[model samples]
Target: MMRDEAPIHAGKSGLRQILRVATTADHRVLDALGTKFDLASRSGYAAFLSAHASLIPALENLLDKGPVPPRWPQRRRAGALAEDLAALGRTLPEPADVPDLASPAQRIGALYVLEGSRLGGAILLRHVTTAQPDAPVAFLDHRSGERCWATFVEWLDGLDCGSDEQRAAIEGARLTFAAFAAQFRAWLATIA
Candidate 1:
């Protein structure tokens, strides 16, 4: 009986209360609303919850004081392609309430354009600057992803592409991505 009064253990994380506040109208309930809720972490938790509502329960479960499940991967985005795909989902332009693509074709196309151009250049730059394998490895580790993306944008932004026809193509792609990325970030901030 005493244990029941003592925050009645609801899974390992802790006691959580969900409230359907009168002021808020929607599926949103005040998650983790409790007498002793930590105000310091509330904003961050809200952001995370907004981003990943489906996983909230699982996240709270894991927040309990114990070793996490063994099967979970260390990082959500494991490889280069996965990271690029995730960025496109988060960053590419779309309508305010329209659906993203069923397939990741557009994002992949953008990534290929970015990587093919800049990855080769980066490799060449590394080889020319230093003979040590570790130097190139470190460079790649620190800067490869962002550098490749920026180079693609730069190429699109009035950098010559050898011929007028090729230059026009690059410019079009650049403008499209630029417009889209701006809107996408704005939307992300709203939900963020």
Candidate 2:
């Protein structure tokens, strides 16, 4: 059975109101963005920090590689990310917008590798790429990790690709990341 009572409010600021509702929302991306800018809701803000706090060390370990080789297992063929993305593309109205299957696979592979290779106390740092002004680094823990769009951009950056191809891949990654982020933020608004 469902209650017919009106929604409750804990008396937070405008921004806080946004954050509180954002956490349980679909993308809940606002939770992430709010944390990034320190504009999160009191409860939501606390939750966000707690979530990433644990991963900090793991992420840092990856960053410590610093232009060094990654340590995750080698996945020469279709992997989790590759399969997931390919499947998603098929269900979409236009798969052309999606990058080649290999691109995302490489991305997931690189992130895994970077995390695997990270040291005991490693931390992940987010940096902006000079090449692409708006392209933010997706959980970089190493110096050479470079700025990427999403899991794929970082993955391709970790690989030994040509300048042109890398550029294209990064661009794709950025778009994917932004789209997901926006969608996630909208979803978060409806969280109870």
Candidate 3:
């Protein structure tokens, strides 16, 4: 059965179901962010990276402070964002302070936003390549492509969290997305 048609089995695998349910709202935030920046220019791309740099590391640090699943890879893109910013001759912006994520489930939920971004990065990379072939795009490059996303989903599906933990994860994901939206808006205001 197709993913949308598949029945959600209750147990260790409901995180994926939660994420699937959240995808629509997630896409809306992503779309609004996309429209907020001009991907065709160097400054615009730098602005995008700056906006992301302000959040990615903060979320990653939050995840690091807790116990992450051993099988889950700790993929970080903030360093790449900094490198790209330097390569583009743009100064790195100070990282923003994200709210504390105190639980593993909440950390995982926030990570869902960061990890899922790789899927969209594939498309963004193509746009950057076409628009600024010489611009550093490491931040947008996910060498493993869909494999990374599949791995994350597989791990998420195997999580054994209870109802409260599940709710925390969902709340964490929502808050992370909202934080990104807020940062994007703030960045746009600065540039405007």
Candidate 4:
């Protein structure tokens, strides 16, 4: 199906479909952020981690404060990012403003961005390993042998979100993506 088109199946799965559709533009932003960092040198990797340090903590804080289902696994990268930063002789950047995810649906959508990034972590881990073989990449390393995105989707599919909730979720995902992209770009500007 087209990126803009909703999935054929409706209901809870449709929330996932709509989120995917609505965040297509945000995906471009994320892709650009990924490319902006060279990732081939120590400084490049440090810059990348510094960019994440600015965003991850705030996002995790929002998720921590928001209403999430008790059974859902909390995926906080702030600690991992800090560990990687310290290992690389880098420090965490000041936290950025997190996207407002007030409702459960919105929190779920924001969580989707965090969980979904793991799908790309495997590839990033490879790059980090090649660039800095011994550098601590614990955040990316955690995805090893884990079906994180699949598990998240299964949990997402089980949630009972109506149309309004689905829209809120989509908005939350878009906002989270946008916030991360904006923070990364701003951080780059400061370093450059």
Candidate 5:
């Protein structure tokens, strides 16, 4: 269950749980925003990649400039996303506005969103592969089997978040979710 869904009341004192509560609505809205893509056809899958390409690259770029989370290098999906798009004979869309993940706390918050998505990616990978088995699916396939999420959550939960840090983290997660949502909505507009 996601931090939002089913409520992971375990480790209530941890930053991961805190972020889960703080960004529950944001996560829900973002997921709903993504349901815009059909994902049943190769073209719809391309649109899905386009939507993500617009935001994931911006987040990954910010992480490159900051105190990155554990296994962050391995967690990056932008390259794989680009490779998949190329295989589909498509190019990445322009990135959305970069979220201001300036501080370590803020970056951690962004990382929370980034790592958290991997859980959902498992389900998405299955659908995409079944729907378009021949499509380039590197982005969806990236690290589908791993302990990265647990490692990231443990790192996130262990940190002692001061009030300032907590606030920054919340802001970071909100910005990340919001930016992705906006980018996805814009892509949907184009498709419509």
Candidate 6:
């Protein structure tokens, strides 16, 4: 699902595919940093969650301010994020400022990044469960039965996206990725 290949040249203009292609570089960079930590260890897990704390909560809060996007409340993870951090006796870091996501297209684009992250969450959850059975993975262990990703994708594919809409969507996603990368780097420095 996290294809890093060059953008598709086929007649594919679906929002899903466009977002995937646009965010590939961002994904790769984040993945590199993501792999740098050992999730099984408490310290490493705390570091990982702290990096997330800098972005997800603030993004979710901004999303909450407007008309809720599809499954918005269900997808909010700031509370679950809090639970996981508290389980480790750590507090969620004060949220970093998110870019202003004022447009509906922008919100959907941000949602694309947010929902896409769930896929990665499943993989991380596996690593945690197998190696550190007691690790509190409340953030990762979200939406046990709901088809969050599928529904989001279906809603995304339903949008009638023109070139301008596509550009905005891609911009929103890129900004989010940048925010995350910046936060991750800052957290990494503190721990180093």
Q: By lDDT, is 2 or 5 better? A: 5
- Across residues 1-192, which tens digit of lDDT does each residue of candidate 1 receive? 552123221232211111111112211122212112221233322222223222222322332222112222321112322232243343222222211212222222223222333344355445433543322122123245554444433433322222332323333324323433333344346544
**Considering TM-score, which of the candidate structures 1 and 5 is the better prediction for this target?**
5
The 10-residue segment with the lowest total lDDT in model 1? 14-23
Model 5 misplacement above 4 A: 1-12
Cα RMSDs, all models: 24.2, 19.5, 4.8, 3.4, 4.6, 4.3
Runs off by more than 4 Å, candidate 4: 1-13, 66-74
Per-residue lDDT over 23-82 for candidate 6, one digit per residue giving the tens place of the 0 to 100 score: 899889988888876787888889889999878988987877643458788889988989
- Positional deviation of 162 in candidate 2, in angstroms? 1.2
Error of 5 at 78 (Å): 1.0
Q: How many Å off is the CA of 51 in candidate 3?
A: 0.3
- Which pairs clash in the backbone of model 5? none
Return the candidate ranking by TM-score, descending.
Answer: 5, 6, 4, 3, 2, 1
Q: Which portions of model 3 show Cα errors greater than 4 Å? A: 1-13, 69-74
Candidate 4 local distance difference test against the native = 0.76
Backbone clashes counted, model 1: 0
Query: What C-alpha lDDT does candidate 6 achieve relative to the native structure?
Result: 0.82
Query: On residues 112-137, what C-alpha lDDT tens digit does candidate 5 reach at each position?
Result: 98889888878888887788778787
Candidate 4 per-residue lDDT, tens place, 93-172, comes to: 88877887888778888988878888777888998888778878888876467666777777777777766777778878
On a 0 to 100 scale, what is the lDDT of residue 102 in model 2?
A: 43
- Model 3 vs. true fold: TM: 0.86
State in Å the error of residue 17, model 3: 2.3
User: Global CA lDDT of candidate 5, please?
Assistant: 0.83
